[model samples]
Target: MSDTPPILVVDDQEKLLRLVVMLMNRIGFPEVEGVTSGPEALERLRERRYALVISDLEMEPMDGIALLREIRADDDLMNTPFILTEASFDFEDINVAHQAGADAFILKPFDMAVLKTKLKQVLNSKPRKREAPVAAESSLSNDFPMLGKF
Candidate 1:
């Protein structure tokens, strides 16, 4: 962990991504990176470690749920905190995000204060332990069967 607080913001919407980056910067998280897709997010994760990953739930190619699943599957990245955001907080979506190993959930169109508070909470929380390989494999293979097909 470097002294700088690095964060990854993953969202397909360019406007949202820029807004998040700006907000995070204003909140003292200067070292932030943004990506427009799950694959790009994963690539960024591979290249460097981030204190937290804030992702939008709905996206083209790989959605946030599938991205969360993939992140949890990788031992090196599994323990990293993931904050999922969606425009709506339907029970099914929340449950699926939790099941996929999301550390926190944020609703879209959120106030900057709410996002800042949640980010602080997650960053202050204890580091997570990597899930067992068997569990990770199951999570990746079972939860979103429709993932790769898209």
Candidate 2:
């Protein structure tokens, strides 16, 4: 295999997923993989190591914050860089993502330039190791009613 680590992109929308994967490839990420759901993303992560994970903020069953919490709780995958993307300017969502240990958050409709810059910054930076495991049942959803109880 090549020396470049692979990247995982998760999005419920197939078209968006394909577009993001294509963008990553065009940006020089040769090993970009896309998954349709949070569970599928987790399965992919367990199957192999990835340089980073770019996931959408809104998804059924498990949202980006929920997925992030799960990753943080797992010792093997906890330190992997994670970026959350959303289609809106919801400040509340951003705050929860930060609290959930996301490495970066990008609003949707971002240009290629913005995506490239954010990806480079996240991919190069070391993710902060959590001092304690994330709660199995995070009350973050309760705090953010709009996000629903994940």
Candidate 3:
């Protein structure tokens, strides 16, 4: 990762995306890229590797929850740090995000300090070895096909 690893920020709002990119750059993450939708983000994810992915929880077509689930399902992207940002905080949303392997969750109207802190926490996190669950409750495949076992 060159100096700072590249970050991919996904948000439907163009202004928010721009602002996030600016803030990330100012905070020493110069190699930041923004996408307007989950599909677009997935395309980019296929093309390159990113140190982190910060996505808005609400978006057209595929929302952050769907995106996060897909990311978690893929073995290659499963360990990548994912941060979900939303304007409103919901406990159900938080639970799902955490279960989906999200590293951090941030609120909208981004806080530079909080963002920085979360970035550190996520980056410093050790890689988790992908191990199959021994218990039935550990598998989320029964509900979410994307999160199913191989």
| C-alpha lDDT score of every prediction, in listed order | 0.82, 0.83, 0.82
True-vs-predicted CA distance for residue 95, candidate 1, Å: 0.5
Candidate 2 residue-wise lDDT, 16-92, digit = tens: 99999998889898989999899999999999999999999999989888999999889999989998988884767
Off by over 4 Å in 2: 132-150
TM-score of 3: 0.84
What's the lDDT of the predicted structure labeled candidate 1? 0.82
Q: Which is better, 1 or 3, measured by TM-score?
A: 3
In model 3, the runs with Cα more than 4 Å from the true position are: 1-3, 132-150
lDDT per residue for candidate 1 within 1-150, as digits (tens), equals 349658999999999999989888888887899999999999999999888999999999999999999998898998888999888767678657867787777777878887887787778877666544335435443433323321
Better of 1 and 2 by TM-score: 2
Maximum-lDDT candidate? 2
10 residues in a row with least lDDT, candidate 1: 141-150
